[model samples]
Target chain A: MVRYLSAALLVASLFWLAGCGSSGVSFNGKDITGLMPDLEFSLKGEGGETVTQARYQGEAVVLFFGYTHCPDFCPTTLTALAQALNKLSDQEREQIRVLFVSVDPERDTPELLAKYTAYFSPRVDGLTGDQETLRELTKRYRTTYSYGEPNESGAYLVNHGLAMYGFDRHGKVRLFMRNDQPVDQIAEDLRALVSIQ
Target chain B: MLHTLYGALTPYIFSPITVLLFLLAVTAYLVGWRRLAARGRPPSAWRSLSFFLGVLLCYLVMHTQFDYYSRYMFFVHRGQHLVLHHLGAFLIALANPLPVLAACAGDRHFPRLAAVLRPVRRVLFDPVVATVLFVGLIFFWLSPSIHFDAMLSLRLYELMNWSMLVDGVIFWLVILDPRDPDRAHTSRFGVRFLMLVAALFPQILLGAYITFADAGLYDVYAICGRAFAIDAATDQVLGGLLTWIPPAMMTIVGALVVLRLYLRYDSEKGG
Candidate 1:
């Protein structure tokens, strides 16, 4: 029993050394596995239906972490997502859905967020909720954020990792796209990911 | 100054070296666009290199202006600033193109950077940020007291290099960032048109200053300066060209890039 406990302690120390324990993401969350932590979410999209892990299953989804109030990065990224979609052939474009989840739920109401997403692309959907639900999803995606930095204003910024998750038609996470990975590369990667199944 | 400008204007400046370097750049660009160039615009490296060289050429022009001004005529100095900041800066920026580093790095490094920038790239790449910075820098530099200070102090010479070389590169990056929504959100017609106009202002101001100044701006280029066979009047015209011609070429080329982008899409209205 003592030997087994020592082995466990050694593994735990390794994880702690790597800093994954301090991360808000599930310590068990797999970075390369095509599986997001099966969290339930309600996206204000497509007739305002409640979206969950099952709904995204068997569909290709491109997900982003952002807020409506973001002047530079958030809105621009959403637009690029839209443009990349638009660049695809009709068949390819039809098979994909872009999700914009607001990290700031305090101000980004569903209706306001919906309006912002609609301006860029109709196929784009916005998601937001109370802190509890937001925290749950952010954990599953391994996204990190903080409030009120470099100033005392109510304004806050998210310093989350900027990778796009590509879930195949199986709803399994298949690939990750780094920020500004070029329109063509993302498009080709998506095509390959979708064609896999 | 007139003699120097004359020497620069002669054929050697536009020699086979320009063409050879441009062609070498073309080859590099071809390699750069391994995927897209075949199908779409063959993203031209020649154009970008030309822009880089144009900025360097303007740096040389500033050298001449410095030589002209040490003797105390202020108008030529002012004209030089106008040239370097707006005209020279924009043309250089437009010509050099943007994210050349991204293009050169290829598929692997790009994704990592993209991931890093995903949440934050837009802010750094925003056209408005560059526009505001450039406009603000010019606004600050244009203040009369500042102008007087730049003329009197040796540091303004260095500062001019910063505004023209550094700030110039950044502002042009935005104006030319085709993928940047903050920039493209303007819609091509208005954005490109505005870019040209904003680019043209400094050049126009410089010519007006030189032509209208009551006394010569630089002591070095005073009436008593060495009389060249070409004469000072002709040299001033060369200054105007140095300020205006390269920018005009850049703008026309920029318009072409924008128009080509628009036309490519317009023709693809199969959707």
Candidate 2:
């Protein structure tokens, strides 16, 4: 597991890691052995470009999986995550990143994901792609998601578990914050994990 | 702030010494929530709240100091009284059965306290007991002789304050018994309104009493006015109105709101 994560980190740093954004570390684009598996996947962006795992390597990341049409859990989790981030002092908090991954890739073009994630937190980075890529990423991340047929409004929803992964600066999952936990605790946990020198 | 109230160490059932104690009492239910979520654990919220409240009471009694409010406007000081003792403490009791005495019956005090607190609980939990205590509390302070006596002794004043706070809480706890299955609904809005009503109902009557009462009451307060130094009668009425209005509106209307919410929740659940 450890090597797998390290490999992902190394490979991801190749194309991205530009302006690691005050997180005080940058991926060498060299995969570290015995860590996270390398996950090179194609994704859509609002302005029509490819987003890959490499884009987020070496940054402390908060990753959540859901679609744009979620009713309760998605919004609640996002709101809670934003609140947790808000609890910290600006400097300590700014050294973090949030990524939204769309499980319902069939309809969740990168554009939809980007717009949806933006509603909750400006720091959020949304990534979506073709069906195969989304499926592979979701499976690797252990994200639980299921799709429902489109309803009358031509929009269907996906029910997904609201779990967030907290990654270290090295792009390694360090802590798991459940959606239902209090925001203060979540923020504290995130800051503590990131502050670990 | 904790330093201002001496004998704050001696919690006295209502006025706890430290904010830390208050936090503990407030967070007790979180333990129960976890238990329910995991092992189907027996509820420890009641015990936790009781212990926390006891800690506060002990802190208050040991270090009771009134310097902070004593320095401020008298009304604000009294407002503090109506909040911590009367409202805040009661809300804690209703939300969690800080059945402090009921739970940790000290081995030594077991027979004695039960003998004492049992009747007290029976009467307190009863509506008639509540009404009488509530009425008696109103009149006791209103009477000049008793009022003067209360002012003369800090202990007396503190005792009355504590009693009123506890009695006030006990009164509503019985009225809006959260433990009662029929009254308790598993709805967030219902619970919130339940809290609002429990707080508001008493205020309505008290507000009415002060708004139109003919005679001046409470010589201790009338003679010794606090902030903005109004006349004794005016202060007394104003105090009554202040006490009555917000809490009453919160309690009754809040309850109805809760009932509406409860119905909605039931409809949603199709139960």
Among these predictions, the greatest TM-score belongs to 2
Q: Tell me the tens digit of each residue's lDDT in model 2 across A92-176.
A: 6777888777777767676777788888887787777777776556545433345566778888766554557667766654554
What would the per-residue lDDT of candidate 1 be over residues A4-62, giving only the tens digit for each residue? Answer: 44434533553332221111122111233322333346544434556665666666777
For B1-271, candidate 1 gives per-residue lDDT tens digits of 9998785544311234334544654455446555446447545776666565655556555544343332133334444555566456656566544445456556787788778865444443344444445555554544443443343223443454455555665555555545533344633545655755675576456545544544323322321122222334545555444545554565566667666755655666645
**In model 1 chain B, where is the ten-residue run with the lowest total lDDT?**
B219-228
Q: Rate the local accuracy (lDDT) of all candidates.
A: 0.54, 0.54
Q: Model 1 chain A: which ten-residue window has the lowest total lDDT?
A: A20-29
DockQ (C-alpha) of model 2?
0.00
Worst ten in a row by lDDT for model 2 chain A: A27-36
Q: Any idea how many clashes model 1 has?
A: 15
